[model samples]
Target: MRGLKDKVAIITGGIGDLGYATAKRLFEEGCKVALFDLKQSDAGLAKAIDALYIQVDISNEEAVKLACERVENELGPAQVLVNTAATFIFKGVDATEEDWQKINSVNIVGTSFVTRYTVPQMIKKGGGSIINFSSVSGFVGQRNFATYNATKFAIRGLTKCWAYDLAEHGIRVNTLCPGYIYTSAFVNSCKVLNLDIEEENKRASEMHLLNRQGQPEEVAAAAAFLASDDSSFITGSDLLVDGGYLAK
Candidate 1:
């Protein structure tokens, strides 16, 4: 919790469950918050938290650059950056080149573009924290998940490299890998695939030792720790908030 007060923080995909939770936590910890997404956030939510919302397509370098600049101008140089914007595409070896491109552009390249622009601001403020979201998929393969898993794995890889590259500048980079979190996205995906929500939920819940899926706020707590000085000694590591899912 230390080192979080008065810091400027940015959360990409801020309208999403996990991202929104993280933003709320950071804001509560006295950090000025900014949310970035491809679409505008609900006015009530943004106003409730007294945070700024910026519509941005992270895959577009120009859009990312402008958004970062705008944040700096409005909220001050960002000292914490959480990259949560991603595209999800579940496919196997049969995945088309287009599938790969669509997922990679957002999950990988988009993450990089946001980080690329935010680093300078962090450097200006004498260092910062960067939390990149990965998933249990990053550590293990799943059936029909080649497309999505690849990007998650790459996120961890990028986090490690960025940790080393930015350490001298006082920036710490780490990956937040969560297990199956009960989110709107999860239920919606089940609907899209014509799977029973209850059945799918049971399947996912059983995958973790806790016998339940995680909540967005639970994951948000981990992100807050990483964002604060409490995790100053940790970097280039994979922090699993997976409900002991990996223990098995």
Candidate 2:
């Protein structure tokens, strides 16, 4: 994990559950994290790490470009890029077009923007790693999550194609697909579905082969590997850190 030492990383959505955990892990590995999140995200993770953080929504292209410029000016070219910022939707076809556009913009389009801005820097720096945050829903399917599933699935497609495109530039592109994990989002989802929080937690645990819901740190560990030399030979692979959910 410490192989990430001396590297600079630009981690999107770097203040929330998964993002915060990843940032902590990267910091522990001796990497400097330039976090791009919303206005609130800066506050959420400020006390946790001493790093450069910018407030910008993922769906805004100009905002992201500005954020990248600032990141490059403030912290050197990013040697590692982790596109973890995403908006989750749990609605089915009944989901409104506006909502669909919003989620798709952030989860898919915004991911592209971050990649667009960061890749050149990686190339100039002699290549690097790009790890995307996809989900199990992309591999299989999930109910009442059509909008979300679309974006996650699109992320995998992006990963696959980018792996080949960036390979010549010496950049590795891979996707990290996680199953259901315990987070504020999950807790809110349980409430929205009218299920008892504790009950749903137990249910999620049983759904996984490990009989437990994964923590953010679990996925963060995988990100560390993909970002470091440990996974130098890994590209275009969907690494499932889902506690065996897909195995079942």
**Per-candidate TM vs. native?**
0.98, 0.95
Q: Can you tell me which runs of candidate 1 are displaced by over 4 Å?
A: none
Candidate 2 error regions (>4 Å): 42-44, 191-194
lDDT of 1 by residue, 70-187 (tens): 9999999999999998888899999999998899999999999999999999999999999999999999989999999999999999999999899999999999999999999999
User: Per-residue lDDT tens digits of candidate 2, residues 1-248?
Assistant: 64688788889988778887888888889888888887465454655776788889978889888888888888788889999998876799799989988998899999999999999889898899999999888887787988888889999999999999999999999999988889998898788889899988998899899998999999999999999998989999999998899899
**Backbone atom clashes (below 3 Å) for every candidate:** 0, 0
* Prediction 1 TM-score vs. true: 0.98
Q: List the residue pairs that clash in candidate 1.
A: none
Deviation in angstroms for 6 in model 2?
Answer: 1.9
